[model samples]
Target: MLIGHAIFSYFPIIKGWELLVAQFNRIDPEFFWMLAAGFLAQLVDGALGMGYGVISTTILLSTGLNPAAISGSIHTAEMFSSGASGFSHYRFGNVNKKLFRTLLIPGVIGAITGAALLFYLGEKNAGWVRPALSVYTMLLGIRILVNAFRKKTASRKVKNAGWLAGAGGFLDSFGGGGWGPLVTSTLISKGRTPRFVIGTVSLTEFFVTLGSALTFFILLGVSHIETIAGLIIGGVIAAPLAARMAGKLKTRSMMIGVGALVIISSLRALVKFAASFF
Candidate 1:
């Protein structure tokens, strides 16, 4: 529990030596669970290019963690995880540099705006944010499922970069997940090449996540150090492997996997919320 309290404090700012010491100095059972969550989430996200946020956030929410804090912790840790994923995608020739640049700036802007909104909204009414996010995630999941059955066509260049990336970033920041679900699903459904879309989106996530996390830290202040650290450690371990697997996966399979996960987790969360009203 105390470890949970120490999970997400300015980790990137900490000296490498300090981080190394903290890892060894604070050995707690709870921290290991956090690490495991991170590892599993990152592995899924890496392989499928989505899931870190939905999976991790779902678990934390079920455990009764604060919604804002969970989002904060996820974005903070994602700063590192997305970076690793992006690097792997880049190395594997998955990214389209031109498309990456087009999406990056808008995504960052939307993420920052969304983070600020979430912080303010959550402070005023935390209850609203969690359930709302759960519903939104569920809807996105359903969209993916519909997309999975759609016929593939010849790859075409993506248009409306501003709208798509901005919306994805906003949804991602506000809901604490959705970059892949919203962006990847939509683009792939529109006939964008899966390999490039996954790679570009994965890489752009680093920026979107970084901006959102920074906004959260600025407004909400740092929190959940143990949880964040555990997630970061686990994600780091899994990211490279996930990146390697991304190119190998079929796009339809990836959509099905992501959609199923999102639907299940979101349904569970929503059901819990509905029960709370009863």
Candidate 2:
């Protein structure tokens, strides 16, 4: 009772609490939906090293927001979520320093370039770009699934890994998300170790997302604060757990999960693109 009186003496604590509750009550129901989306997306992304942006973007599109606004909000939230995921992966000993170094600069540059193009062009080019990227990613997913069933072969070096990272970063920023499906799938198909590839890619994603988010903030001025906040909170909460799962899953199981997620996301994108025609 004395503690409560002391707290009350210091401020209008009850009034402030009431106001906060009122603010929360007034928040759009979409915030709660986005919160759930963020948790699921980050869980998949952390474990498989992809899908957060794709999942979040798909949900946002249903809200009738334009491509630029969706991308802006997703990337802005990704800055925090990916940072947390990267640290969590690092803690789990999943990050490959060499691969991370290879992907970092090129990924950042490509992300900035893509974000700039998306800002300048808006959604005018999304029709063709989305379909093309979706088809390509779907093919990659199929390849990954097939590889999961094949006999183990000698791992081959990924030629022009920098170029692949650049392409991934570009598409992820431009199309809302494809980095994991493109870079991770390509690397795994090349016979790279799944654990290291996923971890390194997850680490690199933070920088790529940082570049894209900054670009969006500059061009778009950070609209959708509540949506971004919801995603960040949910993703952050799930990051450590997802990273632990990444470390524990078998290589084949991880590959299968990654392949399925990529295929599903790509198919969804294609369907949405097709629907736009009507």
Against the true structure, candidate 1 reaches a TM-score of 0.79
Off by over 4 Å in 1: 1-26, 62-64, 123-157, 265-273
lDDT of 1 by residue, 1-278 (tens): 56654664534435756889887777877688888899999888877667788788867776678777788888999899889889998998889899888889989998998888876775444345557767766776787778777785555666898788898898788766667766776676566666777888899999999998888888888788988999999999998888887788887887777678777867876787789878
Clashing pairs for predicted structure model 1, backbone only:
6-225, 6-226, 7-224, 7-225, 7-226, 7-227, 8-224, 8-225
The number of clashing residue pairs in each candidate reads 8, 0
Candidate 2, superposed: residue stretches over 4 Å from native = 1-23
Residue 108 displacement in candidate 1 (angstroms): 0.5
Report the backbone clash tally of model 2.
0
Give lDDT per model, in order.
0.79, 0.87
Taking the tens digit of each residue's C-alpha lDDT, what string does model 2 give over 1-278?
99978888886788879989999899999889888888988998999988887788878888888777787888888899899999999999999998999999999999999889987876577456778888988898888888888888458999999999999999888766768888988898787878899999999999999998898888879888888898999899989999999999998998898889889888988897889889
**132: Cα error in model 1, Å:** 7.6
